[model samples]
Target: MTTTVNQVMTSYYDAYNSEDPDRLAAVLDDSVILRSAAGTGQGLPGYLDTYRTMITTFVDRMTPQRIEADGDTATVSIVNTLTARADVPDFMGMKLKAGETLTLNLRGRYKVRDGRISEIDIELA
Candidate 1:
């Protein structure tokens, strides 16, 4: 059976919060593209690299405030809370020291193909 867009997005967020690169990659297409203020990444390898960096640098948690899906597309409003694991001199224009926490309100537009996420465009909410 084919997965619905909502199911794909739910799996994506669950994988992200799990902080397992392998789990997150499972929900992504091989050629997935992710665009955000931090940077843009293409392909599974690039995406995994970004995920590793973020998890290593901070304790990150993504909480979905709203999720709306139609056909193969999904739009999600999220609250991302990050507690620095190490001093980050600059992160998306913010500086954080170890033990410090920062929260961001974000919106993400996702495109799903087959049962995987193909593209994600993220921005500040």
Candidate 2:
């Protein structure tokens, strides 16, 4: 059986929590798009690369708090807490801590097609 949108979202979050790029890729369409407060990506591979970098270099974990769907669209509410590993610029480009836990509220919208995520719109809370 094919995966449902909810299952895809759950798997995506699980992949994220696992910090595994290959796992993250499994739930996304090849042409998946990600739009967020941090800009956007055109494909799943690029998104996976970004996630891999974030997980390896900056973030420690990202957890989904809730999920809801309306037709083919679904929203995943998540809480991401990151532990800085290097001196990285903040959202405004200001240099920040090398090791600090930063909590961010996130909401991501998934557009599903053929049981895969085709588009994702994300925002910071």
Candidate 3:
């Protein structure tokens, strides 16, 4: 398939925008791997599950600020403001409480295969 970088990126964003794990899964390769500034995971599903759990933990809404793609890769820059619903350990291991909004700048990179992401690397920007 002649999948362009833009198409793959659009699929990835659509999956995230929908917040549907199944939809996200549809665009992930079975053997996908992910590495973040926080940590790394073995597969795409596991990576998605971890973030989903975090969203349930203390995040209210997440928004993307920008996205860029070239060849078989894409990068999404995001500004995420999260409200702590309960005391949770952040990346810095601080105790955060409800109603506290933590703003973070993040960059995520995707490696695509057949219009699906087979690997990802994320970092704090």
Using lDDT, give the best candidate's number: 1
TM-score of each: 0.96, 0.87, 0.80
* Candidate 1 lDDT tens digits, 1-125: 88899888888889999999999999999999999987788999998999899999999898889999988899999999999998999998889999999999999999999899999999999
Q: In model 1, what is the error at residue 70, expressed in angstroms?
A: 1.3
Off by over 4 Å in 3: 1-3, 60-62, 89-91
Clashes found in each candidate (C-alpha, N, C closer than 3 A): 0, 0, 0
By TM-score, rank the candidates, best first.
1, 2, 3
Leading candidate by TM-score: 1
lDDT of 3 at 30: 84
Cα miss at 114, model 2 (Å)? Answer: 1.4
lDDT (Cα, tens digit) per residue for candidate 3, span 10-58: 7776676565778878888888898975677988668778768766776
TM-score of 3: 0.80
